[model samples]
Target: MTANLHLIPLLPLLGAAFSLLFGKRLGKNVVTLVTCGAVAAAALVTLQMTFILHHDLPPGGALVDTFFEAPWMKAGDLNLSAGLWFDALTAVMCCVVTVIGFLIHVYASAYMEHDENYTRFFAYLNLFMGAMLILVLGDSMPVTFVGWEGVGLCSYLLIGFWFDKDANATAGRKAFVVNRIGDFGFLLAMFLIFYHTGTLKYSELASHIDGLHNILWLGLPVACFAGLLVLVGATGKSAQIPLYVWLPDAMAGPTPVSALIHAATMVTAGVYVTSRLHVVYEAYPQALAWIAGIGALTALFAATIGFAQRDLKKVLAYSTISQLGFMFVAVGSYVNGSSNYASGVFHLMTHAFFKAGLFLGAGSVMHAMENEGDIMKMGGLRKHLPHTHATFLIYCLAIAGIFPLAGFWSKDAILGGAFAAQWDVKNAGPVAAWFAMHAGKIIYGVMLTAAGCTAFYMFRLYYLVFHGKFRGTHEQEHHLHESPARMTVVLWCLAIGTILSGFLGVPESILPESLHHFGDLLGEWLKPVVGVQLHEESAGQFLGFAFVATAVSVAGIGSAYIFFLKDDGVRAKNFVATFPRLYRVVFNKYYVDEFYNAVVVRPLRGLSRILWKFFDEIIIDKLFVGGTAAIVNGFGKSVKYLQNGDAQRYVVGVLVGMALILRVSTHYSAAHAAQFHVDQDGHAVTAVPQNDAYTTNVRFKVEWGDGQESDADSAHPRGLKHQYASSGTYKIRLETTDSRWQTTASRSETVVVR
Candidate 1:
């Protein structure tokens, strides 16, 4: 059964390939069937695998299957192979990705029916699902990177699905470029890990983390630098503070894309990576502190931005970032003496349900309104699109952390984990204790505030869009109708999920004594992979935190009702007018985009222009290009002097060259006359002695530049007929000796071989 794990992702990949290659030919209905069927089958396979793993596998055990194995790469003692790892963590992720992914695909079919590029949209969605599955299931980091880059490519394609819009294409490019920055960190961390440990396999790296931690690279602990790099990569994919700007603009893609990629699966990849590598983080207290602090800050910061957004999808976009921050808070809460991996994953799961529901519900509303995304232009939609209104309300209540729903259980677990860290635990180290004492309180406070802001903005959106009088043009009002049954069906399914998924992570402290055993089911299921920890909070303490969270949510909801429902926008406008500067800043997303343009983008462009002008155009071109041309032209002119096109002058020059060579040879022979024995005719003597030896022999050998040599006797002492190889210099040597072998003379001269 584990061997079949490869099929889960392969199915969606095949669907994407088919849709991309033949979608137009197959028509829209067949395209939808292929895409949705692939995801649904994947979901079913995941469910079966989850059940089998639960029933058969022992606690704290995993099953690794190498469906296809080849030597991907090897360096010294390190080897990485492409494979799949199926465990409790992967099982949970598979369920979330495939189930929610299938639901989004189903919803997209109805939402995108009229679009000409509907098939292309489904193809991109399937590709994203397949890539995300590979990311979760890959047994090694390098293999996972293949999927990481795959999803990034799919994101660019999907985000700019309507390439006719410049803004959409620009948004896609922004997402790709920002993610590349994070991926650089990811690639570096992988290299450092491989350098130290000589392997990138997840299991090997996990087992060797302790041994490798002390190995420093660039004067920092390997764990610290590598862990921080991983966090940097997470910040980009998970939409944490500095790298989060791309997500809100990603709403330029279709609404289902917003639901699937941004809200549910892709954005949660950073949390998954962090959770998957819990061992590395657990060892570095400082790294854990950074994760906690950053998570808390990003959570509060994004939620505050959400307060002023008028665009419906943009509001949900910021809301996803804020909720992801809460998950990171759970991830970073290890300083409390518990890793809280299960809590982070629990929130990831529940947030997927409610957030996906919310985004899809927004899509339903948009479908009805002819694509009006501004909530300020929408009102009193409850009477018109009752199903969408109700489902959207349920999503609001769930995400607002109201009791019994998914958000309340998972979010409170994280808050409780943060609170528990404040309690001093023996042997947990002073750093952990100090962080729990000092930073924990601040994190808790900020996260609590963010929670209230979350409820406020969500309800504010709800009231302004569904409760007040119609605020848009009459034509839009007339067009307001419930989405098709196909879309609403998925919304209702996700709504039920929002209501029920919370039970999987219910805290034992919050349950009655009779039901305490059933609580924390998610923790138990995940304990085999992530390890289990007892949070150990009393009933009173749990109740106290739960009450505070619920009160803040109710307060936010009440404030929204008062401002938008009862006061008819008078107080809201006055509040904005009173703090115009602050309102404008928040409304404009703190001008972070402008800040980046000024500090990073514009400077890079200016530097590139300078380099192009001075280095490329002036220095490189003038020195290399123009100088080479000038030198070649001068050489051509020098050679042209020889090409006078006069046959008599060319022959005269050759004869003069031969006379010069003979004159030099005669001068050399006269300089050493004792070595030359003359014949009776006063000519140079040449003889071949007995026993194959030469004595008093005056033989001349003429060598040509063609590497051919010929000997000339005393009768024919001129140069031999030989063809030159091409064009170059040649050397001519002469040797003479007396019969008594008393002296030997050798002379050499240079001549043109052309």
Candidate 2:
């Protein structure tokens, strides 16, 4: 079956168009219906297509549906089709983006009901959904980049939805500019890939992998160079480390938009893209390690930063970044002798469930607390918002990796894969072996710590907000109430997902021996697409990692309870009092943003000012735009003298112009532009004349200047020969004419016939 894959994205795009065009006239209710219905309908279509992909398609096959018979983009050797590619990987992403997007849409309908731009909000949401689906389903990289830029544009619009607020607008611009920086890397990688291989379709690129295998770019292997550039792009989209500053600020948008971005769309794009193009990374182990190291570091780094965040959304924002890092680690661990891409994607799924639920819960909390975001000011609201509290607790526990929850299974898959990693240090020097031997363990250890931090900050957010006495003002306290059914219904549904989603990916080693057949169905389902891991795990190794994972999760949760809730946070207070400097630093996000502002943002702004002054104002404006105008005006002034009612001067000018034109047209030139060979001890010469232009039909002749000449032979210009009597210097003459134009040109030169 063709699967009619284009309709999946088409539905939402149409909805966005309708919402933007006629939404105001139709009223908010109609806008909401079209918006949510479109995405919901797309989700249903995605489910149907996914079923078809799973049951009907052969292994390693796709159900492709192109929009037109001809290529959408064709230039010289480049041809790109407008099409949808349906495979196991795309199937998984479609479910995530469409399903989560639908939920966020439904939630937003209720969340933004009172907003003035409610219709516009839904329009942006639908647009975002459509673009993300395009990103997932595009048949080629250029097509994918269309969606890439589409989402980037939507992110700016959605993040700055409240344009009235200066900070919100700045945050949106920040996301745009930072993502552009990362997008440049993606663009460069595409250029390099296309340079080595003529096509950009995923299947075609895969087939042409060997063509790029041994090629080098800028002193590095092509694969390595491309892989590094790809990683740079992933870090920006996924919010890993240096490019991560934009995400925390993205909370300036509506909460539902935040859920959509964090769970469904933009952030997971990086991990998905890497998995989609794993062939590029297969030849470069160091590049793969760069991914793992960055992931491990970002996970730990973000988790540590999360510990000090007071705003509920900011905490989850950092938590999102940290979890994304874990996904990066999962995808990047191929060099560690494992291709746990399924685990990485699996984590993306589970994170969507728990994190979206968490963010929704935060939105719910904010709604009840009268829009208060700081958890430090929130306490004991569980009594008031019972449903929100229950779902929030579930999401919190799930994200903390409590057993039987979604996070545990996926996090366990990644860790198990990490532990099973085999470093190839054979035939290496001692230092190399030492580095290889310890690198895997070090990464594993950092991920473990990050996992622990996940539990710590999540529960810290939960306990601080839900467990203590009410701390807010009377007016805010009076406002506390459970959210409307429209919103809480989504919470409970996602809460159920947080509880049940993990079982689908339960690794066999974590289960009893009899349940082995039921375990890792996700891995089995995805194997045809992502392929099997590089290193196979023994039961003992997997089970061992699972055990440590549970222990660390429990320990982190326990630590949070003891420090923040057990004794009313007195130990936390004492610890903070003792380490105020450290606490302040972490609380301030290590001043990385400030550092960036000082080093990057400020310098760039300063340089931009210089460019605006010198380049834009002076060079472009004065020298180019104004100078052209000035030259035109001055030429007009100079030429007006000829038209000063002076018929005599006008006639002279016209005649002079005609003469120059005639001279240029009648110019003539010629050359032998031919080939000759000497033979018989330089006694004879044969020549082939390729006369220059205008040398037609008259004749072609040559004099060997050895007292011999050849007859004119324009009709048969190939052979007009003269024999040289001996090996010695001589003068040679060539002549040609165009009798019709009455033009003749000739050349003579000294020659040696030897």
Candidate 3:
């Protein structure tokens, strides 16, 4: 596993490079063949690994990373490794990604064969798979980000693959920009992790946190901030509130690209990031609570929007957003109460299968209908594409959470996790256990209702698309046909995955304790690396299962059947007229996108305009230009004063200054002479008081009051000049115990000879 881990990411990258570079020369068939083959090979390896893990699990064994490195990204004490891991979680994710991704690739091979940019399309597709694989297999937060940003890049490329269409290009740009909102949060959370634990490597970070007592002012705040930041990233990537508009519009791309990126690979990156960092979230349960609340709101919000959408892809796009919200709520609940990564991730895995199947099925219908995506414009095509219809029906049921299907099992597991999280009364301390006992029922009810909403909209979408009269024109109907065999095959494969993938988290009541094993195996594999216990619901979890599973599936399908399958003509008309406001609100998608444009987008653009004007015209042009002019004017004024020529005035000033200097010099010399002292070396000297004047080794010899000179060794120094070392005129004075000395005669003379 270790030896081949790095190869997994590298293989798809090479395939992408090859297809992009030589796709034109090689042609669509060859390009598709090569890229699909590379991913298929990777899928095969992943399946083999899954089987190995399955066998190991039966024997109560698990797998971990074979090897990793610290890399060179060390700063201060923080250490992060740009390494990869191949534990059970990564292994399962790898299998899901490669297998589903490969199927989509195959489907796109035939679906996109006629398109002009076929090579570029496959290039983006392969790049997305490779990046997604790396995201799952990363051993550290930073490594995960590399994969994260990589997937976003691939999604932007693939979404805009058909650049000829303005809408397609716009959709691609929307996806790229919207996802940036989430990516920003993710990056901030990583910074928080680095700041706190000083390590981003899962193993080291997990090992360092212990006893849970370290969570106080520093630790708790950091944990909360990190969790929230990561949730923001999750919201953006998963298409949660305020950041999800791009997904529905993303249908502008080719259908297979839509299925590949929206369903299986790109959008679900948030769920993966949250689940991967579940351990960090556990330390800040308040943040987890917020995650659940926001997730629930988004789930309902998006679900309502799905009900209103006319476009088949848009409905599924909202559905994807809604379903991802469920996953987030599940993860949040797991973190706060149960620590059940298995359930949340189990839902994530099964979601990829069913949602991918659904999206691909939608694509098949669109292809059969000549690229029309609106359900309102499609109908009665079940007869034309039996394989696509059947596969689509299975996927529809699976997403609706019907029993024995993959979605039912995974969805039930999430509800169960949510139930357990609300009140882990059985194991927690006394105070916490007591609160859980009181609030548990309320929390459980909310999650269960969310599940019901999930079923309703999904069925609504199914009814509109697959179970109706042909609403398209005669010419459009003439083009209706089954998807090519290659495309149908991919649909069937995904249908099977959607139907069977739930066994990974099957409820324990149906299986023996020994066989009730999947969650524990996966939990054990992730626990050491994540530092959070993965919990299974304690008891009465089956009641939650039965209630939610039964209510949502029955209510959702019965409504759909009544409205679309039976007497829909009268019922829909009556229902719409009776509740026009409700219908209109839902139909208009609650005006959320419109409101966002009016409030957020419009304001932001206005602010941007203002900033541009202020910076370009006001600051840059005016302040700088005006300041330079002022400086130049000041220089002109200052230079005027220097231009005056007055040599006679300068000479008169010099003569007056000389007279003042002579008077001050004589007074200072008299004051200093009072403390004069003589040395034995025939030189005149003076001893100045420490505070008043100065003391020196050599003293100035000066002429006495009557122009008489004193010899060395005298009681007081007489002359200022002690010796004629060189010829120069020197000022001389004498003093004997007086505050001021007066000169009897003043003479200016030059000492000519030594």
Tell me the alpha-carbon RMSD of every candidate.
18.2, 10.9, 19.2
- Candidate 2 lDDT over 1-754, as tens digits, reads 4658989999999999999999999999999999999999999999998887777878767888877544676788767676778888888888988988899899989999999989898999999999999999998888788898899889888887876756465456556656876899999999988888777788777788865678866766688888888888888899886677678888878899999987657899999998988878776666767788888878887787787778999999989998999998888775443367998999999899889998998999998888899888898888988999999988887877778799887888887666555455446799877776667778888899889878888888888899877778989988888999999999999998888888878766657889888888778778877777323566777677778998999988987898778788776565456444532344244344344234422333344345435633465446544576689899999878667887898899899999988765554423233323332336555555553443455666577787777767455555565666568887776665545445566666665756
Q: For each candidate, give its TM-score against the true structure.
A: 0.75, 0.76, 0.71
Candidate 2 lDDT score relative to the true structure: 0.79
Model 2: lowest-lDDT 10 consecutive positions: 669-678
Off by over 4 Å in 2: 70-75, 168-170, 335-338, 422-430, 510-514, 533-535, 575-754
lDDT of 2 at 42: 97
Among these predicted structures, which one has the highest TM-score?
Answer: 2
The whole-model lDDT of each prediction reads: 0.77, 0.79, 0.67
Candidate 3: tens digits of C-alpha lDDT, residues 1-754: 3335667777888899999788889877788778998898888867766677666554323344434455465676654457676666677678778988888888888888787777888888888888998888888887888899898877777766666655455455455656776888989888777766777766566554432325555535567778889988988888776566667777777888878788877777887777777667676566666676676666756665555567888888878887887777777774343355666677778989988988888888888888787777776777888998899889878887887788887777666666666523334688776655444344556556555556766776676666678789898899888888888888888888887786665655556777766544444545543444434554465665666577867886776666555775455554445433542344245345344224422333344335434532354334433444567789888766544567776676688789779777665553443433333233333322212333222233346333456433233333344443443333334333322344322223322231
Best model per lDDT: 2
Candidate 3 TM-score versus the reference:
0.71
Better of 1 and 2 by lDDT: 2
